[model samples]
Target: MTTDASQSQAHTSAKHLYQRHQSVLPDWLAVYYADPIELTHGEGRHVWDAEGNKYLDFFGGILTTMTAHALPEVTKAVSEQAGRIIHSSTLYLNRPMVDLAERIAKLSGIPDARVFFTTSGTEANDTALLLATAYRRSNQILAMRNSYHGRSFSAVGITGNKGWSPTSLSPLQTLYVHGGVRTRGPYAELDDTAFIAACVADLEDLLGHVRSPAALIAEPIQGVGGFTAPPDGLYAAFREVLQERGILWIADEVQTGWGRTGDNFWGWQAHGQNGPPDILTFAKGIGNGMSIGGVVARAEIMNCLDSNSISTFGGTQITMAAGLANLTYLLEHDLQGNARRVGGLLIERLRAIAAQLPGVREVRGRGLMIGIELVKPGTDEADPDGAAAVLEAAREEGLLIGKGGGHNTSVLRLAPPLSLTVAEAEEGAAILERALRSTQF
Candidate 1:
């Protein structure tokens, strides 16, 4: 068949699929692009659409593909484990699960750590909340403003981003705190040290007004909040106050964990003044795309529950095998170092490009997790339309990126695989430059 004819057929197939998807799927479920393309296969840092068009994947399936697409190590582990057994549940003795748990417990940094595996980050965060509330015996919780934990009902209760939080009803009384975003808040104009002080003071004041909170949950680097974060030591400062009042600190590392931040193996390490967080929840990227989520806490906090709880599919043999292999590959290759080196270059390139564009509000992030916030050319108003235009333009330029923010969704997110090469970074940056310029009206 001719290439043109084949492409037309593929496009038609995708259109039909879209129609079916619209008919059956929830209306609130969102998809990118005006005409969405069905991704067929992926390798390294690129994916091919059903229409056979290849593109550099900058978002890495919402930053879940930590290593790379179709990694041989993860693929082999999943295949071999599948041949033996897929799942035996948490009831039976699972060697792979125990092995991965031991490794994560040691690497987690919490003293006498205990790990509880879950199926997704939402579940992991939910587990953390349960532990914290049970341990402290308080339903009140503290969470950062513009932070996103997960999509589950319990997780949504703690989420500060109104866009992601569909319902106001929640099991926990979550108090949203300030100081997550450094660029656009009351503390935006302050220096790093002063900003930390102000946020700490705010926390102290908030605590005075509320009941004793169980825990303070935060994303060291707010992922869905446009990759925004407070000053490095801000959380550490809050820890001092929370510790005084016996409040636990839970770091949501679903998007920022496993060395994605480059400089630190875990995002919480960036604010490691008072040792590790009391509870740490991780998912995304640990299994290198496998469904793996877990919460790591000290033995005392983790053992607070009296009733028995077991995840039937949380630490399944296949997922554990995949997690073990993926973690080994990540460490052996020093992909953290790779992220530091390559992501540095990519951010610099994007920043340089942003310098010439008036609509580009700010480019902020660390390591591979970067965000380009868009705004009106001459004003500070968020340009959600401009962001959408740039996203479509980049897709046309053979690049796949992501969009995120608090409520406006005006920030362009770029988080390529940690194994991304310098050449690929440069190529993606070039495409982004053109895409950004295309929307400069």
Candidate 2:
């Protein structure tokens, strides 16, 4: 096929931009592909690259685009709010902020819940750490193995993943806990009952040795750790123990919030028997690409701070308007129900394909969030090269995907928009199957 001149020019522009990007940006920013293609625009679940190639977007900008690309409602809300006023700090009364906060408090399921908005998940979690340590008067914290909280210093101290954690210098003392990743840890070989018992016992033992921790922070499903998760009710069991010790529980729902998991609105609901978390941090999907993040907690914990604080950019008018509109559309459409139905079918289709692929060590996830772990044929050793090859091959087939894991980073991550259609799921799976086949031994 002969390419159009305009498309050819676009490709050249992309190359030129990439060179400028590399020269100016940090080296660790990490981009996909050997020859990276700049995405110019998107609509719904598809995006067009610089070379006029349209690809099915499965990652959704790391699951930030929860609803869809270029959603008219959100666009309209943002435009209207921007035209009126963009930045009015938290020093004064913000009606849009109050309205959105009220909606989130009721939906949060925490009794007498209070909300504090932030600009990103990192800030939300950082605020939580501040609340917990101040309330408990201890800098010690408990975190699960193979988990990622955020990028801030306090966030990194609690982050269990070495890949994402950039430094060991931190003000807080962190104790790594078990039960985050069930299949790869020492408790992996045990049955569900035994595994839960073992992890709880380890937690108790760990607590006996250290000072009382301010909180136990964890992600229900390790998002950046390759979509891995412990068995259902694992955190519930941990909660029982922590409750006895007066330790608070913090649920970081950054990637798992807003009905992405299908079965539960928040990822922590899968382990809700112990009651809602003492503090919950959320971002990413809630804003649907707008920069909105926050923490919800009971008034007791949220009001414990004696000193005053405020976020200069948090809970601004425009982002709040976008959140209100996006949340309204999401609830009206019952995207959670759609995620359950469509995700169920998509997982089945991927499982069927994985059965025929030797490199696919495991296919795991819930709802719209799914992952495919790659290995060296029959061996259990991770095959990161195979993952990269499959990623490139899928791009060639006009499909976009992502990669994540613990030690070796060998799992293909898939978290498309929650409103993805069944036809789109089928198409993505077919392209992935071809990509996987190309990586065969």
Candidate 3:
């Protein structure tokens, strides 16, 4: 019997029955579900929903599609890897796992890097957290306030948003440091030295009296918090502080890693002055749509955790193959160059849009990772309604966007596939421009 119903009443009944499957879902799982045009498939810089609605994908699944969607290279690699061998236990020591691990470590410029793979960014971040705590044997972790590490219990406890309010998530022993204004920083036009000094001061104050901590975890660029990238020396200064305190610095590159930023192979590379992070975590683009993420820790850190370490399915052959293919695609295509070139175009266009849109306050972010903060006239630049309206309208206009930030729906994030071209960038911008131009108050 056909499930498709012809009459409206029949259609309603069918839909209700389909939705009934969701009735059994846990409330916690449902909490994170934001309904949208159900995406059916994607190719290049676009996707179509089940309803046959086509969309220009500007934000690459929140910067995860570093190579864009359905690229021949990534697809071919994954396909071949799948054919060769899929899921062998990590204990078996597959070629894919070993190869990808070696590649990422070399690219990371970290010495003697070892890998602990996970299935999602959150899991990788959790591994980073656990490794940090074990390595230092200290309970406390210092992450920036308004910084999003991940969503699991351990990562969420340190997340500073849900954790800071109402009650204390004390068992985690996570500490927070304020990064900056979180939205608008008047420090914009200030000299780099001045900004670095201010950031250093803020960190110092936050770090005061905390005897010692395991790690200082941070997104080199605050992706969820509006792609906030500090001055040149900020990371360097922060690292100096952490090192002086004997605290490991974990770079949560889940958003900014893997050439998502124009200038570097990893977001951490952009802060070359700062040097390498002791621990690095990655996910999102590694397998394209396939789930894979991992942690890269220095030898010392990995060694510290080895005694008590255990996780099943941490780095299976299937994910390793997918990750290897993803890495191969990046290295071969010079995708980082595309990110730098097209990202500059996209950012410039967003800035241009900001110039025209009364509600747009600032257009900022690194590489393909871009954000537009919406503020109406006479309101604080931190105002957010305009951003929300833009996202909703953009979706209606067949363009996908992501919204995030600490307190307001002010930030419109664009982490489009690294595969986006200059022309595609312009087209996506046109859609956004139309969305902004047509949005109601």
Q: Best-fitting candidate, measured by TM-score?
A: 1
| lDDT winner between candidates 2 and 3 | 2
Give the whole-model CA lDDT for all candidates, comma-separated. Answer: 0.94, 0.93, 0.75
For candidate 3, write residues 1-441 as lDDT tens digits. Answer: 233433444545545644764787654442112333446689888987655557888766667776868877777777887787777666676777788888888887888888877888899988888778887788798877777777777877777555223345645687777553434454555577877777778778877866688888888788677777676557778888777878888888888777878788787765557579999999988887778888998888877855555556767777776677777788788888898899898899878777866677778876788877777665655566667677778887778888776657577888888878888889888888888888742
Writing each residue's lDDT as its tens digit, candidate 2 over 353-392 gives 9998778889999999999999999889999999999999
The candidate that achieves the highest lDDT relative to the unseen native structure: 1
Query: TM-scores of all models?
Result: 0.99, 0.98, 0.90
Q: Give the Å error, residue 409, model 2.
A: 0.8
User: Where is the poorest 10-residue window by lDDT in model 3?
Assistant: 28-37
Error of 2 at 158 (Å): 1.6
Query: Per-prediction count of colliding residue pairs?
Result: 0, 0, 3
Which pairs clash (backbone N, Cα, C closer than 3 Å) in model 1? none
Alpha carbon lDDT of residue 119, candidate 2? 97
Root-mean-square deviation of Cα positions for candidate 2 versus the true structure, in angstroms: 1.2
Misplaced by over 4 Å in model 1 are none
Name model 2 segments beyond 4 Å from true: none
